[model samples]
Target: MQARAAQDLKARMTDALVEAGLTYAGAVAHHTPRRLVLSVQGLLDQSPTLREERKGPRVDAPEKAVEGFLRGAGIDRSQLQERDDKKGRVYFAVIEHPGRPAAEIIAETLENVVRNFPWPKSMRWGAGSLKWVRPLHSILCILTADSGEAQVVPLDIDGIKAGDTTYGHRFMAPDGFAVTSYDDYTAKMRRARVMLDADERAGHIWQEAQNIAFSQGLEVVEDKGLLAEVAGLVEWPVTLMGEIDEEFLDLPPEVLQTSMKEHQKFFSVRNVQNGDSAGGIVRFITVANIETPDHGATILAGNQKVLSARLADAKFFWENDLRIVRDKGLTGMAEGLSDVTFHRKLGSQADRVARITALAREIAPMVGAKPDLAAEAAQICKADLQSEMVGEFPELQGVMGRYYAQAAGHDDGVPEACEMHYKPLGPGDTVPTEPVSVAVALADKIDTLTGFWAIDEKPTGSKDPYALRRAALGVIRLVLANGLRVELASTLVRPYHQNIRAALERHGAIPAEELNLPELSFDKVGLVERYQESKEGGTEDVPAVDDLLAFFHDRLKVHLRDEGIRHDVIDACLAMDGNDDLTLLVKRAEALAEFLKTDDGENLLQGFKRANNILTQAEEKDGVEYSFGADVKFAEVEEERALFDALKAADGAIKPAMEAEDFAAAMAAMAALRPAVDAFFEAVQVNAENPVVRRNRLNLLGQIRGICLAVADLTRVEG
Candidate 1:
């Protein structure tokens, strides 16, 4: 009975397998062994080891079917994967299934699983109920065995059944037939003149293009972006050389290059030996979409015609600009400046130029340039805004103005300054070493910074819309790189305060009279009073000029840190009053850093710290301040009297040394007192039995602190 039951099951399974299109071929001849071999090409009938049933309305989703088939196969979820949409069909993986063939089960599952499939965005078309990127198409499914025959997998999507064939490019290929293996499928596609791998085709195009350029003694400015884009646009790539019309060669090379790259996607080629020649012609490497019989002559001509029109427009703009320069003085070019907004809150370009001119006049003498020339340079710096060439290409801002100024017969320095003012625009950019250019450039940047600061638009964190941080760094590079002895605070503070006052007046935020302060010299006490009053009455939201000066000191530390200067050294130097002069501040910081590397300097700092700590502790504990002079008469011990004498000598030497800006000499003189300081601390007892002596000792420590701090804040030195 069991035998009969097994036979019945086997017959039913064999019938089902035959209906599913499985075939069996046995006793194939083995030529080498002279023997017959059994060949099987069909599903094995057995009780199902894994069973999963998915019930849904009629569906056609390949991905859904793939999921159910993998689940029913007891396959790991990690083994199943989905990839990007191909043409209009979604692709998915199906793992091994028991009882039924893997591909067959996947095909059957898809028909039932896709009825309730969801799509983020989908469309329905034609006379079918199925939805897809386009209408449903044929399914390609096959399961191959180690022997030879492919187990037929039946599937239908909108009445389209699974098959084992795929065609190549329609125009280049025509014949199509069944594919027994993936290798056979790829081989057939290749034989039909199709590149199955996109990267291989791209590599061929690049190598050929490079070879052609190298053979001609020219270089192809290979743009990877253009190459990738062109690769996508073509099934086959063929490189061709094209020539530019000589008439269009008069345009700037940058213009020619931009036109060719933007409009035609042509690679610009340069002659190998034309490095020093301005008249060298531009060779364009054209990438052709097809290998044409005429070698892409038609394509080249079409591209050249478009490029010629672009260059002609550039030439027209160039000529029109030269004519405008001849008709009007560069100053007269300000008529168009109204249209160019400098900043949303900072008025027009003309207005910015006016402010910069005012600043240049104030800053010129410090950089050793005549005020008149600096002011003139700043006035017309933005005048190129009126030029047609600059209007077309904004990058030619200062460059166009220089040409116009020279054409108008302005001073030689004026024209040069106009071009030089926007320099050091980036890290690799050259600084304006010329005195007039340096003065004007500093003025322009300072005006931008102060103007922005006045309007409360200072840079915070990484959000500098105005690029004030770059401007500030440019100012630092200009001053330090040129060895200019300009005071950043003196240059920035007055202009900054004035702009803030102006902005306040313009907005009716403050009374005009409230901002009016008497002009007093830096040495005058009235100057401090006037500046304090301005701080109190200036824009309520904006920080004071004093606060801005502090900000500059902070920026100076940041700037010097990269140059190997210590932050503590910068702090020590800046602690002195009137250290606002950046050049002097930097010199002092540098000198102090060099000095601190020495034994005397190191030991002196340690001594000074010890003295300071003791004095501070004494003052706090006694509830008494000791910021007074130490009388020589109160010195009882020999060491105390010796320290007093040393202090007098050192103070006299240091005063003259610092006045001469000989900070090293001043530090040297201070070092002379180290021994005396050590002796005094060793010999004398502070908080002694005698009140006057103890008070006197405390005052002596305070005096040493004061003298050392006068050179620099020694307390800032890290031991």
Candidate 2:
């Protein structure tokens, strides 16, 4: 009964709109939300008249065309008003316009009605000169019954008129019928087997896919982007399960998945037990636009045929790639590496791999990896570049190499390293956990960074074409997450110099004799000295290692800032020497930040600041500087003796705590000195009349400086 009433109301609304010279577009009724949204397109075609009493001519120079366009759109002339130009575009405004529609309907109307306006990038095809993102098609305009019973809103664009009816899916739903309201329209469309909203269709597909996977004790790899695109291409989704040809199963699973996704848009399914098998039994699920009467047999067959052809190409590449691998023994793969450019300025992949191997060897001990194994892993991490599977699917570079390396009977770590090296590619990605893999991954990232920096190819303003920023972040995560103690500068500088030297040698620009000289030779020394001078002068001319370290430090702050560490804490930790051990540096920073939250830490900082300020003033005022011999005999107050004893105890405790990597313990030990420090300040004056006593006080302040500097450069900390 409600449906019939809605239908009757929709017919009456359509009739009224036609009589009033209006048009209708599309409409939707949401059930869960219990709302009716009527999408009417073309109401903006109306125009209003201008009055001579308001100003001069109703439409002036430059806006006459727009006024004429509005007049042709059916807008009343009396309500036309001109407004100020804000966007520098000449446009007239409508004031006190009587034909008002819902906000949603008006927004839709503006989009659909302005078809023939001159857009910056537009096309005119077939017969008309209408311009749009694509060619103009039929406009969907509709009106709901809830607005009013007798009223009709005018909506017209070009010559298309609004109606209260719409069609569904092209094949499954070919017929259109009248609808008196949005509710009736949605119901009829649903009955006709159509999902009007793209998101609804996507949700249905994913839910069905998950159901299928769950029934078989498997999981669906839900790709939101793929789901959205597929949803747009269909109206009604019907998932069909199919199988690849048994022969094609010999191809790597990644290859199979990539081929199906790229060429056929099919989702690859994995066997419940065989997660890593390349040639294991694989099932593919496909989403079709219709539910055929044949239960999707014909669709499945058609898809299987298409997939067979794609798999054949993949098989050919796999077989052919093995032949190349056998002949090349990894070196054959390196042949095309030169052509596979790392970056236009960073040379080839082979060159990069070589540099990476060198760096990995150097960084191995720092991360507790066997140097030889680290070098070996780095050398072949990119060997998959020679594989046909990787060539077909670039995203599967590391994954494909693992399979090929295993096939070649290489060490298990070698293949695993290949897979792990490009890891932590994103925020949620895992860092290489194994010692060998971590070493190689760090090496690979560092080499890329140093190479790019050497060529002055650093990232600028959102333009990091080389992914240098990600690589830097990966390096930080790998070190900190794995608790490695690598010196970033030592590891980065050698590779940087090596790459620079290689470039010079390749062009025959530098003499062979000069190249053979030690790294610290005259030429290298001169370069280092020049860099140091620039740095001292506050210029951006530091060595690549120093600059890269600074960049890494910035990346570290970004990484740790989210963990709630104060910016000052990071600065203080980084200002200390031996900060290249990123894991240790972060540990120290985190401990110190937590300690600073305590009352003892707060008072210690205050006392330290006070002592530092007074000492600085005295040093500046007095010509003579104080030295470190505190005269025990001249100690006039017990507070001074207590402070001296506290300093000795803190020095003894903090040194070992830091050496043991117990930063929390070190901070606690430093915290203990606060009370003694406060007492000394309260009980004694540093600027005493006796020269010996003043010197002793100055030395005590210097002792505080030394102790604080032991843990971190407290001077760099902000109050």
Candidate 3:
């Protein structure tokens, strides 16, 4: 919030200055915990005077129009100049704008900025109408001249006048200090026991903490976010290391780190030799704003007392959750999930888990995982949601699940899968490499996408309340990164049909056993037909799986485009069959993208487009499709006969290469025809005077179109 507020201040001030017709070379904002400072360099003393020519209506235009133009230009008819336009004579008005002094504009802009600053939360105190993030103490507004003279900008806001004075270190140095410029101000702030830059403060805190920990043969567990927050909380930082109670050292390292950081703003210290193997978080470091007479010994005593109470509560939750996991396995702990609703349209969390389990089992063989293990892992991945430990710290959901699964003595992969399945949460995050984890992860994301898509609750524009876009991207990443060949067209149908059936059953719109529905195809038309056969309702109830598949294609385009593959290349590949297999689709797109960069591939594309255009136009004009039967006997030119032989040889190679999914080889074979096709078009005319020759030439173009389209829809490839 502080950083954003500082940025907003800079932007708003710059806009105001520009509006006042003043120009500055550059501006910068400095954000600290208690202050936002803005400095503009190379500021102009005053704006330049402006002279503008305003065009008005023609001389013959309506009287009312001419009068309105004159009034808008703020000029009389005597001052207007007449010019001969192409249409008729026109009027032009010369207007001049006077500039204002910089000091006057700066005073007004500063007052306005202070009065209307944007804050996430603000408070009013002492019967003052002015609201601020906290009680306003003082304002520092100074203009330093090039001659090293400092002058305060004249302004008053809510009875507080602007000045060039600032105080620092509320406890250590409460006296106010005045400075001439930014450099002097920062130097004096340091002497006053304050740090002016947030980044510098963070760096200092981290280095001192690390040095203290290393001196004791320990290392600080680094958390950048916590370091930043602690830096913001102090101006003069004094790092102190303290011991943790041995009673709580047996807890998990993550739990200890999370507890200390979240509750106390403390950095965990780990033993260098032990690491995080068993119990490594034996000490913690805290930052204070002032130096103490006794070197923070009394402060550590007080903080340790408070920290012990917080850890006692954490210990209680951990012991209670473990006792339940010991009494009943993780599955038994998850039995209550049936009462927890996943969504209003969707069923309970238990219902979602069931769908994921089934999908995981179905996807197991394709991803090279055992069906039983994948199913078992998916069944209990969310069991930790019901544990007491997770209730207090929700971010520890999957972390606790892994521990509980291990305690339950599940398989090696199952325990790991419990935690790893939620991974790749972002583009920077890692995806699971274990087979069981991969199967469960894919199943989880696919079910989310299809289920929401089934209920007509798809994401619209930027409002993805259900994160459907992330789920789709997750599926794409999982497939492409793992080189998996599971076809999404079929994989998405079963879960979608299940969601539709569940919704219908909940509404009593269809009887469960009476439906006896067949497997719905990936296309929406097939789903509509299946629904019509079962009931009289319209297609509105049918899930648009084809549209969902298109959504996946859109996300895949974005994903591949980030890797330097063009969107048009992806669109060309999407036009082909088996685009549902993202791995195959991306491989073909990558090969085609590489191919388009070459001279042969570029010439081939042009030739294919030329042939396709001629064939399309001939078919439209003649009202007949000439798709085949291009006889070499009617070629009439040597280039035409060579193209015929080249087409045959290319077809033999491309067919097998395409079958083997060697897209590079297929593209290479297609590129070999570029010279032949270009020569034929260059030497022969398709619309010949002889009727049979013209028909044969058109048929030859059709062959070119067919062969190129077989590799990929080159017609969709853009220049």
Compose the digit string of candidate 2's lDDT tens values, residues 494-527: 4345446556556554565544322322223333
User: Model 2, stretches more than 4 Å misplaced?
Assistant: 1-109, 112-131, 136-153, 157-164, 177-189, 196-200, 216-219, 222-224, 273-281, 338-347, 495-499, 502-506, 509-542, 621-645, 676-705
Residue-wise lDDT of candidate 3 within 637-656, one digit each (tens)?
A: 79999999999999999999
State the TM-score for model 1: 0.61
**What total of clashing residue pairs does each candidate reach?**
1, 20, 0
Q: Is candidate 2 or candidate 3 better by TM-score?
A: 3
Worst lDDT window (10 residues) for model 2? 27-36
User: TM-score of each candidate?
Assistant: 0.61, 0.75, 0.89
Residue by residue across 359-384, what tens digits does model 1's lDDT show? Answer: 67767777888988888888888887
Error of 1 at 126 (Å): 17
* 466: Cα error in model 2, Å: 1.7
Best by TM-score: 3
TM-score-sorted candidate list, best first: 3, 2, 1
